[model samples]
Target: MKKALALVIAVLMVLSIVACASPASSNTASNSDSGTPANNAPAAATSSDSENITLHFTWWGGDARNAATYEAINAYMAKHPNITIIGEPVSWDSYYEKMLTQLSGGTAADIIQADYKWASDIVLQGMPFLNMKDGPIDYSAWAEMPAEYAGNKDYVMGLATGINVKALWYNKEFFEKFNLTPSDDWSWKTILEAGEAVNKADPNSHLLWANSDNLNAFMQSYILQLTGKHMIDTENYKITCSVEELTEYFNYVKALFDTGTLPPIEDLVVYEGLAYASQVPEWLNGQWGMCMTYASNTLQVLNDSTFEIGTMLYPVMEGATDTGISMMPTQLLCVNKASPYQKEALDFVEWFLKDEEAITISGLQRGIPANTEAAKLLEQNGVTNAIINESIAVAAKHAGSAEGPFDTNAELNAAALDYIYQVAYGVLTPEKAASQTIDAMNAILATLK
Candidate 1:
């Protein structure tokens, strides 16, 4: 239950877990790759029916999510006075690094919350989460789930809380104030033009607010549109995109920085690993125009805000290699394989995912609920945000690929993001950063499995 603050604590955790054989194939690891559930889920029982126990649940979020979570957990506890649930909420920037420490030290929460990339990375490294078949998680409600957001059934990692899709979210007031007409069809080129106009009109306001994670996503989306491929071919264990392609990507990133399309690296670096763009003063004050990151984060970023927000599908050129938008699991509720209270942990997870009361209290905080019935109930209750639904709809329409755990390996992601800052700060030329990134990534990929 102790929090580890060290950033460098455990990329090395994989050294111990790398022995796990991947249940999915080298191709895009969809549910079809998950051949079968190793075993069926245990019959469900309410936590109220079980013995008195204390469980810890941890996740990264801002005030809105953190608040809703506690309310839901408290409601559950009220029903089952014997069970005490502790909520440990941390900022997104610090969440995973802290988890790396806890996971390595065998002190992770009983019920842990994981980003899809983190879940994918965990499954790719090893089945470190308690598989559904090994726990009392009810599977009946997740039947209509797509192969994309569904965890590897072959490995049977824990299920998604909801779906997450990235989009270009903007401040409607900011755009109008700048006399800009932003449209869903705008391309990267149009974005640059709009940014230039905003910069010219108000020297104090910038066009976009993107932390390192957002920058990485935008770069990937761009390259996917250009190359119809991801940064790394996890299936082949290679950086399949050529060095030249990587250079173009980096150059595009550089241009975004230099031309005021994105805030300068120096200004944005303070928020490098922070979860929300709202953490940036310029963004929080409405001095920035857009945030192109996870739409699931909309509510968190709108904390104490005064402006209207808008959504557009992430930009793609008219004729591109791929649309490159992905609809993925917002986060996974996984029980720690090492936790002694895993049975109890899965107990909370099932209630969180399936219980109508729990879903109502936590409606859309995580994204659209993965449970079909839960989704319908949320809609019926008018709990869905109009802005977030806009993003989910547009993103789903344009989704062009499935994400594999390999493509999002945590270590490989770190390597790529590290070079992104170097490119942004002019510490390395685009060509140099690109080649070094490929070489560095390939070296890490070689060691992953």
Candidate 2:
């Protein structure tokens, strides 16, 4: 009987040891199922569809833009758990230089924020940004002008984020205090007369704040108005207008200076290299009543003012061939052809441009939304500013055909500015300045061909 009882005890002890060993094996299987660890679990888990892709999106803007973009990116990532986006925001001054270097070295971000003018230059030079025509991005909701930019095959650029046109920004209080209303006609003669009247009323104030950059833009519009030709004929690889035509354009600018409708060259010089209206003394003090600026920049200008601000039609040259208002894409988004995540990059762009939530977050900081539905959405939500709405409407009604890619040619613009400064300083007759400008521009254009 003792021998039999000892045998039972030994059997029970073995059973207990077996049960303990079972849990160790089961725990390993449980860890594997829960994606915790099984000693050799893959370094990173990935969805079958996404493979855990990551993309880099780069752009240049101020603090507001950076913050808004980051928020939008975060929202996108929340909805797309398998994807990650890295944001690279830089200042406008160093943006192009750094991008160019990265592009050449094959290390550029997968998604690029391209200047409209730079799109053609980069794509046509054999850089391979993905062609959206082959992609899933729905651009049917964009306005005609911005749509045109996206549809071009040689450029094959991404959707425009904003539509920008040069607008006349004015201080409403200054106009009212002088009993001045902007001319309904928006003709050069009428605008100058209005400016002269305002300057006469308040010796401390000037009719307009003119800087070389803005003045150059005005000159381009005036030339377009007169000649019905783009300043540079990219197709022909030459300047479209003659020296005589440019002289006439410069003479008008000179008249603006001589009559005190514009500030002296010396006064304007201090504001060079500054990008915002808020930074200019004349704008801050309300001494300058009006200026030429992009629709995209109107908010910043308005924010710094103590009085209500208004927008006017871009001035027209009397009996001119064009309205002198060019509506162009503010900037574009492009996908690198070499990027491993091309489809994902395009997906983000589609969401960024057309997504209602993203548009609300973006507002008009980048100018009017290029997506028609997005713009309407802002209006429906009562978030669209009245000034921005008016500017968009005015630009749409009066805008001319978009400028050619070469219109914003860096070398040509630099040469034009130099010649303009010479005319403003009385160092050269308008004729001489015009002649020199044409020659220099044609020389540069020839090399480009």
Q: Against the true structure, whose lDDT is highest?
A: 2
TM-score of every candidate: 0.83, 0.84
Candidate 1, residue 264: lDDT: 68
Question: In candidate 2, what are the lDDT values of residues 322-413, reduced to their tens digit?
Answer: 77576677788877655655567777898899888889888877777878888788778876677766776787787676666666667778
Expressed as tens digits, the lDDT of each residue in 263-318 for candidate 1 is 76777887776766666677768888787878777777665457777888788876
The CA lDDT at 30 in model 2 is: 26
lDDT against the true structure, per candidate, is 0.74, 0.75
Model 1 pairs in collision: none
TM-score of candidate 1 to 2 decimals: 0.83
Candidate 2 accuracy as lDDT: 0.75
